[model samples]
Target: MGQHEKVATSLADAVGEEIGASLAPVDAELERLYPGDPGTRQPVHTVYVPGDAFAADTVRSWGDRALDALDAHAPDAASFAAVLGLADDLAEPVYARVRAKLEREPVEDLRVDFEDGYGPRPDDEEDQAAARAARLLAEASARGTAPPYSGIRMKCMEAPVRARGIRTLDVFLTGLLASGGLPDGLVLTLPKVTYAEQVTAMARLLEAFERTHGLRPGRLGFEIQIETSQAILAADGTATVARMIQAAEGRATGLHYGTFDYSACLGVSAAHQASDHPAADHAKAVMQVAAAGTGVRVCDGSTNVLPVGPAAQVHAAWRLHYGLTRRALARAYYQGWDMHPGHLPTRYAAVFAFYREGFAQASARLARYANRAGGDVMDEPATAKALSGYLLRGLDCGALDTGEVARLTGLTRADLESFAVPRRGDLTASSG
Candidate 1:
């Protein structure tokens, strides 16, 4: 028989219970408000087409134009590599994938712009355009010609355009629902949101739409366009962006940066008004932190330096776009906006190169971790999560194929998902 030793701990079980009871509501609130990332296929980039200019073959046309730009400027892998400083080994593979991706799936996400792109228009004219966008998008969906995710960006909910924006949104959604119901990839964007209350209004509007259409609750979610300084910081000096996410009440899907508008809001000169600017980084950092673990993704803003003019000018623009895209990816910002077709090649080039460059090493490390085979790099569960997520994103964007990733890591799609996205039960257990 073992003799009992004197207990050194002073606290009783009741004390622990008291603390737990006090913080029970905090636990519930955390679960309700901060749902983790929604494990979904996020697009690598979003391409915006003006409302009136969008057509049935818009996605295909954009791809063709991008391919043409590649053909005209960087006809060979060597030339493209020279322009982007891509290593020699990656040149052939990345180039091939970028070209094939352009031919196969060029535009991952397309937003039909009804706001700034369409400009002010007659009521009837705007109504017709909205209806036409719905019809064309529905037709494209049926024909398998549409991008993976497609939607409209209505005008902001500001006083000057509130009625117009609501009407346009109603027309579009109604038209879509009438034609074989909304597609699974349906998305919406509300631009230039300045106040948290504006976000609440959008949520309420969507809820009303759902009730009117006899759809389920919380069916429509949107990306809040973070362009105004007021949205970033309120007069009271709080992080209004965080408040905005709370205001969505589980309906906010993303926070999209607006490069030009945000830069102008801060009074930055046009020359320095780019996605990688210091001001831009500050804004996006706040956005990123605010959105973390809220299931709200963040999208970087676009660049205005279009790849036009002569060959030299096109090359310069391509380099800029490529560098920006790659930089954003490294910073954990997976998505950005592509305003012009010429930006497509470099966009894909940078993305493809990034994934391809680290493929071998990442695959090996992940394999070792999975097998519990120790290696030079000590891996943690969190590291495994990141590694799996990296591979999955590469797979989603067509940079790495399923067979290849599976062959390398010996993990199936489901296996990778298990590591990348933890279950709620698992999270709760770990938290305790």
Candidate 2:
């Protein structure tokens, strides 16, 4: 038999053996779990970085700084208005330096930090903390100064836990989503994701919130933070992560890399020196590999230490170098985080640089492959292999577009149907 026939037969036989006498039911389950044809095209290379603090003061200051920097360096009206009203002080020299950087750089994504305590907390401060977070979100929304694509990290995990009870997380997220008046494309960041159950619990809560608010079911989406050791060290770590992604199903937008938390879990010192250490890199690499072809964007955690020294020259040099490193990661198909307004220009610079390079390379390679296969070729076997590669690459670069991929690859739309693998739960009914 030919290779393709042999492979298909083997797979079929394996399934039959695994299910024993229930071949039909097993086939049905397999079909549900691995539905669709083989050649789906999805965009993969979008970048998302977190904004350090989204409180009124921080956002306002950030905006002002962005505007002043833009005015001095680029002097463009759009940039000026977009970044204006950040803070009270103009800091002309700082603005001038930032403007210089913006003149040449472009930003694609911005994540605004809503709540994360830096250090130390009292047991009695839970209620106050929640109220404080609520007020901050409210002010940020009302002020209209937050970034266009902002996100919020709720107070999900804190010592002495303020938002208590069984539905505490649900209540906290609901309050933030409802009373906070979040931006339209806002992403909710879930920190310390340990188990698939956590993701499912959160998903159910989101569904309930949508129903209560009269909003569409999938209107709210979340990005999981895989920072805990339990997440990385689980016996079925990869499977668990995949299950978490599948649990979110259509509601998860991306996966975030939490370096510090992850390091702490591994008993590594949570210090600046540990930001991109070998262990962190290996952990992030595993996450990236797991997220491939899943249509879920993955981002690297932020640098914990900020630049210090002669404000203008030192910050500028530090930022420029930092941007370069971020650019490298982006080029490798991993987006990262930025914690401050001053870091915005660098974030965008990295994004645009990475995309410019990625798109050019991908477009050229795809064109070459198309030519080699001959125009409009639709070899199912060949197409499946190529499409798998394309899906992984596209997801890596955030360039997945079904229509565009179909047209370019010369694959029938039907072939793209199998891109999303169905959940194992969806395929089987448990007797218990």
Candidate 3:
């Protein structure tokens, strides 16, 4: 034996057991609170249409309009690339995919907005609209014409509209029940959440709906619209978004930043009110940080700029929207709200270009990591996890073909996930 190697301390095995026992509750709590990302497909953009205007063909119409916009303005990869400053290497592939995406799955997520976009309707009028929304969405889903995710954004839980909001949601869900069943991709949004209590109320309402319908508990989850400053920070100066997640009782699926509303709430002038505004960034940063490891994604808000008018004007608007979408993606906010049909071209263009631009490097690094082969850029398990997620997201959004990803990395989707996700035991197991 080596000198000094045989030396022993006065430590006992019971001491180790004691520490483990003391941490048992905390381990359980952490696991319960942060189960990690669900590893499901997250849409890249959520398109909002006024509730009263949503129809069975709305999704298809949006796709056609986006294609038309591209045909009229861009006409080809070279022209589209000029608009967005897409690199020459990325132009053709991204342009082709953007068109294909618009044709196949134009709207990844669609929200029927009853909150601000559709405002101040009579009780009977709103009631009928809610039911009609459900009917239309159900019909679209049945006919395989609906977006992957479809839902409504109801009024907030404020005192003036709490009952009305509840009634609207009740009518919508009940209407879906009458029209066969809830769509598999159903999503609901509760807008203007300023308090954790409001999240709790929404959770309780969903629970009652489940009980009444004999649906599974937690079957429904909603996105929390972060439109007010109070929702980001509480009166006590703590992160209210974190508390809202806790109060949601595990039913919050996402936190969507309301660009204009949030900016206005912070007193940002209308001209300066944008998603990239410092005020908006702060709110979304708080939201993103709070949602980390909690399986709730944070979505960036949309730009009000519409790509319309003459060729030059449309090109300029496309530049802004494309730049904004690309900026949000780089910031790790993978999803955003798309406000217009014309926005779709740039939205997909940016997304496709983003992933396509990085495809080679990401693939090579993932391959190296998968093979445990040394590379210039050293990667740890955490970095590997991020790389896997990036590729997966790119694949999910039609930016990267599944076969291409597998060929480049020599890994299947399941194989990537094996490295991407961390199990509970991996978090606390003793390292030798």
Candidate 4:
């Protein structure tokens, strides 16, 4: 009964998914990855620290610094409390906990970026960076500091950087093997992938790495960045996300959108490189349709705005991040990139608010549909599944507790657990 009770606390119906983080394999950020309270708090934001600054000791302190910033610029938790309809005294404690979480684990997924974050470094410098990143990976593994989802991002395999990207990956993998082997849940990020051939090439490279390192053939899975126009629309004017996944030959784990780059490819001016631009919507819609049942997770990009002003002025940045995150959540893109510490509070606030606002209606409707007892309105299987997903997401993100989910959905813990293990096809099926 004790074991069951502990295990049942999980969002039993939540599916395995990936979130985005682009960090420079620097020391300050790394040490913080495994904070003091690993399970007490979870990070909603992904840190994007530059590669040049990545150091082992320094990486460890990034989380604490972010927490300090959160405390310093503690935005009026007014909006957060208002959305949940909490009183001032109660909300103050809740906000304090949120603030504590920001400091404890501000980074959920850390991407040791060698691409844009690293930029173009000298060959020897890039090689050294790869080596140091490998060392950090080893240390993180030993200390249990690696995030639940973590890895490195190499330069694009298109154009002039293809050879360099391959070399960087080779060096990094070699170093990782020598240090402590690949960590569990490590994903490689291939940025600006424009053709099926690039993905196929990466698959071949990963296979080679596995063989050379004495690992299994498919040990490494990679994510493709859908940044360019070609990645979205091929020369024949067809959707490419599914095709790229197919070319990955089962090595494709996720697809991430590069908001600014994609917009630039569409010829949108710098001023208009916004997340909600119609161009992004069209591309993401296509991505959702093409990769629906393939199990390839899709991640939205981060906002460029940083909260650098005084506490009074920081809420604007918070509001922007909150709005963007909310938009992504509404579209079912739960995971996204977080570029700054300010984004941490808003990320959780937006997610919790979204889940809390619709909880009662969604739970009632899902219960009625699941029981085959029609309620006030017609409920289709698809709607039921989406409703179930909403509740599951709430549970997964800690927005709703397992007990609350059970009460609202009338599902036992085991039933909730079963709801979380379905394949994409099963989850999205027209009939249950």
Q: Which candidate number would show the highest TM-score if scored against the true structure?
A: 3
Measured with C-alpha atoms, the lDDT of residue 329 in candidate 3 is: 97
Which residue ranges in model 1 land beyond 4 Å of their true spot? 1-17, 424-432
Candidate 4 error regions (>4 Å) = 1-46, 57-62, 79-97, 369-374, 377-381, 410-414, 421-432
TM-scores for all candidates: the values are 0.95, 0.58, 0.96, 0.81
Lowest summed lDDT across 10 adjacent residues in model 2 is found at: 37-46
Candidates' C-alpha lDDT:
0.93, 0.51, 0.92, 0.72
User: Pick by lDDT: which candidate is best?
Assistant: 1
Q: What TM-score quantifies how close candidate 1 is to the native fold?
A: 0.95
The RMSD (Cα, Å) of candidate 1 is 2.8
| TM-score attained by model 3 | 0.96
Considering TM-score, where higher is better, how would the candidates rank from best to worst?
Answer: 3, 1, 4, 2
Pairwise TM-score winner, candidates 1 and 2: 1
Query: Tens-digit lDDT track for model 4 on 83-104?
Result: 4444565466456546654554
* Model 2 CA lDDT for position 180: 57
Task: State the lDDT of candidate 2 residue by residue for 196-216, as single tens digits.
Answer: 777776688678877987787
**Poorest stretch of ten by lDDT in candidate 1:** 423-432
Models ranked on lDDT: 1, 3, 4, 2
lDDT of 1 by residue, 26-133 (tens): 889988888888889999999999998998888889899999998999999999999999999999988999899999999999999999988999999999999999
Local lDDT at 10 for model 1: 82
lDDT score at residue 205, model 1, on the 0-100 scale: 96
At residue 29, what lDDT does model 3 achieve? 94
Candidate 2 regions off by >4 Å? 1-60, 63-115, 118-146, 157-183, 235-239, 270-275, 311-331, 357-432
Instruction: List residue ranges in candidate 3 displaced over 4 A.
Output: 1-10, 424-432
